[model samples]
Target: MSRSRGSFGQIIFADQSRIYNTSTIVGRIRVCGDHFTKNCYTKTILGIKKRKGGNVSSSFVRSTTKSGRRKGIRSSHADAAPCGQDAPEKDVGCKSRIVETSMPYADHDYSQRPPSLEEQLQEAQKTIACQEELLKLRKNRFFLERFQCDDRLIMFYTGFKDYITLMAVFMALQPTAESMLGWGQSLADQHIIRKGFEEQSPPLIDQFFLFLCHLRQGFLVQDLATRFNVSQATVSRICITWTNFLYCMLGSILVWPSREKVNELLPLSFKNTFPRTRVILDCTELHVKRATSKVLNSETYPYYKGTITFKSLVGISPYGELTFVSDLYMGSISDKEITQTSGILSLLEEGDEVMADKDFFIGDLLSPINVRLVTPAFSKSNRKLTPEEKLQTQEIARLRIHVERAIRRIKEYHIFDRTLPMTTLGSINQVWTVCALLTTFQGPLF
Candidate 1:
């Protein structure tokens, strides 16, 4: 029993420690964050009293030694708890806490404990072991390094094209596996790319496979990085490099045919209905990330997309074969300017009719070349079109669906489905070129 100097008397706690000074005691009640457990408490827990009519019937006391370190506790209180904190239960203790901040790298807990020398050594050894395993996997072999347990792996990553088609593309790009064994010999002999000082990187087949995997599924760069056990930057570099490589190698596969060739391969549907039509052409836009530079924003902004974009003129043959794909132009350019500069008009033969949407007002542009521009009828003086003009527009619309389908096929390659990144905008034209050409692999557009 203890007494104070004034009218207050001390209630002696037999086993529990009482608050030494009432006014001096820090009165802080905490609600435990752990809903899964009742035994969570603040780091510093002060003893509290449970009273009925000013007499203490029971006391919730947390004790510590002279060292001032709290011990394990297992008790629950009926008294009110502070915001976001709960008193530990009578059956559960600090030892039963779901999140023990005492440990290093606790999950969902920001608490961190500095590593000891032994832990640091173990981590270094683990890193070294991983590096050694990676080196073993990435050794100079081909065809079965990164993936490729079977053909299913190929289709899952590189689209639904057959293995033969995939192998053809791979071989065309690789040309000689011998070059893959060395450096740039495959592309160097072909002069597609010059040789450079080789860096220790993944094999050619693996790189090609990686590129295909990215294109086929449009996986995020970070995901590819983790899959390949490399950094996102490395995955990005591989994507850009292989994008250039595949586009350069495979682009010629979908070449614009001679007039005779185009005529010979024309599907009867086009030959009978739209005989004079050589190519259906239109301008398409791909939304890209907004640039920080005002000039860049203005240059890339297209009113159609209501955002920054890259505009390309797509020309498809009568049977849906891509006749030509132009380089990406700034969205700011007029359709007439793009048509004149895209080298598309040059591909046109004299007397060839260019079937297009009404927006492609290039009849005067085509007139000097002896080429014709055919589009739906336009109203004059605010009057409706004649019946003949309406029938003509229906015919053109029915035939023009093929070009739209061709564009849809290109856009199906998910990379172009979303807002493109500005960082890789330099290589985006190549990516676009590749996607456009890949439609050929889908076979005759009919």
Candidate 2:
């Protein structure tokens, strides 16, 4: 077969003086044999398949385009019949020579039309609508329902054991608490004014829950405001209202057990060693912010803590129930001074014994009341303790540590974990008393 080039970038293949033309496009190939030229057979150049009665070898051709860069066109050779061969209409075969040509590279990317200003504004509006709906859902939900089923979370957020225990305390205070003043009213105006924006406050139970969360979690007023969907002033008023309310309500209940009652529920450990022991006493301190006044600063600063603080005396019955929580005093006061002034001595009956730490030197004060003091033995002058004295110290330490554990339980409320700010000074003492009183509802210390 003789090979020759034809016009319009076609290739001619001749067999026995008869010629056939083959045409190509950018990525395709068309073969024509002895059949009418109008009837063309198409085949893909890149992955040409083998037909029966022929063995094929595949390759590609490179030709220069107008841009002077070589472009590749795939072609293949097959050992098949010549152009004059008579073949079936479906199986027409041909032997052709390879040809090289180039065409302009086709552009693959077509950019889409940009959105108009009005359409863009519509999309932005849709996004803002979605965000407002989400915020509305957050504002309308109740905070307590999320914690109702979890006892641990209830204890963590509110210091109550579970929903039932929290509600029990709420139920005790609800009769008076639910009817309290509106958030917008000042504490002094609650009696004079019938109402002022009571409708603006959250549900009464939710308000109570918010108060507990503030105390237990040490949340900021703004944080509690956002969480309860109320203004910061509302949060502050709810906290103040509840603090005073609970202080009055819980304080009215008698926490101290009578001498006879103490004896009935006295622990076996206390009964074996000291049957007359009535209460365990200790002093704890809460750090407070430094004051602007030098005298006020001096009054609040404690030598041991090396910071401004408020000190109070706590007394637990031998059965581990909180018997008394003294009002907060200046931290600089001595343990002995707090004990004497704390009025716990008045509660002691004749022959009643008191348990305390070594720092308490109120033994002389209790002596006139005919009360005894139980404390660990300390070294006298420079003398070390003897073996018998050592054993006695160990026994007293074992018993005295219960008071420390009781104090620690009160400290676990994270509100006291940091220094008290000046802004809370108005309600700080009441908050302190309320936290101690609430510990009674935690079942028992033992």
Candidate 3:
């Protein structure tokens, strides 16, 4: 009888040319020749057998009849398979080889190390030491450049530091004397002045030193000319050039501190003694030598000093800073007239107080601005003060002493303590302004 194979078991099919491919079937059955059966019950080719007591059944053959045909069948089976051939190969022995290669070997070593904190500190210290050494070298160079010996050595020794200190004190103090000498010397060397017989003039540094001594120590123009072996006209011209230069340049640097700043520096003692006091005001006489013209001399002549003089109003703060210095007024002018003419009276405001001597006569000028004037009590018709008036006068005097102290401090500068030479009035005033500015640099007196 003919047999049919089920699709659930292995089945082999061949084309007409005798090429065969194997496939598994899920339904239906087929038989190839008389020896093979494909059915669900078959486990292997050998498991197929003839059924007992039945018509002869197909026997499954385990081996191919030809070896080359078996090889071809195996090749066909591999080609037809749906899976298993593409699976990745396993590396069972690779892990240990990888670990061995990754580890560092004892034959190799690294010697690099980070710097320590001590090394870093030493480097920083060396840098700072170099900077300090450089600064010292620069200072030594500057000292050597300016140091010189001359006839003015004694004067220079006494005033050098003071002069330098004063120059350093105010940004407004011009180096005019130094600059003019430099310019004059250059001009002399270049023969630029008057186009005349060129014998190089004396060094300007020497002349500047002499000029400084004259200004600070009041050396006579004739004396300086003789000392420098120059004409008086040349000396006078040098003085004028330096003085004018200083006056213009230094004037801009002498800025007054703000009233608020002054108020902040006021001492508690001053505040308690004179409440709401704005400034301590006083007028001082600066004597001048006699002039050649009588009319000119009379105009400058001050009856009180019996010599030609000028009047200036000096105002000091509680901290002893020179707050204000009025422009020069003729000595013939009364203190009241000077105060009015100088525009100082215009600064008073309501609720402010100005302490002054009886010479100020500022009551009328200050009253309109609501400022109270403090002065010694005076009786009518030049009469002596009563007991109450005397007590008031004493109280005023006690409060007024602070301004006197401020003035005394200013006069301590020898330039102002002595009678200023008429030839050096412009220079002396400049010196005074600079000295006053220098006082502020010494820290607040209050």
Best candidate per TM-score, number? Answer: 2
Q: Once superposed on the true structure, which residue ranges of model 3 sit more than 4 Å away at CA?
A: 1-164, 167-191, 194-212, 222-235, 381-392, 405-446
The 10-residue segment of model 3 with minimum total lDDT is 91-100
TM-score, predicted candidate 1 vs. hidden true structure: 0.60
lDDT of 2 by residue, 1-446 (tens): 43444544555555433345563332233444332332233445776532332312233245668998776443332343444545444343353344444335644434667789999999999999999998878655758877788899899999988899899888887889767765456678766763455566788898999999888888989999888778898898898888888888999999989998998988898888889998989999998888888998988888888999999999988888888999999989999888888888888899999988888899899999999998888997899999988887787788878778878878888899887887777788999999998888886677
Instruction: Write down the RMSD of candidate 3 (Cα, Å).
Output: 27.2
TM-scores of the models, in the order given: 0.60, 0.66, 0.52
**Between candidates 1 and 2, which one is better according to TM-score?**
2
lDDT string, candidate 3, 199-317, tens digits: 33334445445555555556677877776667777776666655555556645664455567757877776666566777778987777777778886887787877888877787876
Which parts of model 1 have CA positions greater than 4 angstroms off?
1-156, 176-201, 231-233, 252-254
> Arrange candidates by lDDT, highest first: which order?
2, 1, 3
**What is the Å distance of residue 67 in model 1 from its true position?**
69
lDDT of each: 0.67, 0.78, 0.57
lDDT of 2 at 61: 46
Report how far residue 7 has shifted in candidate 2, in Å.
Answer: 80
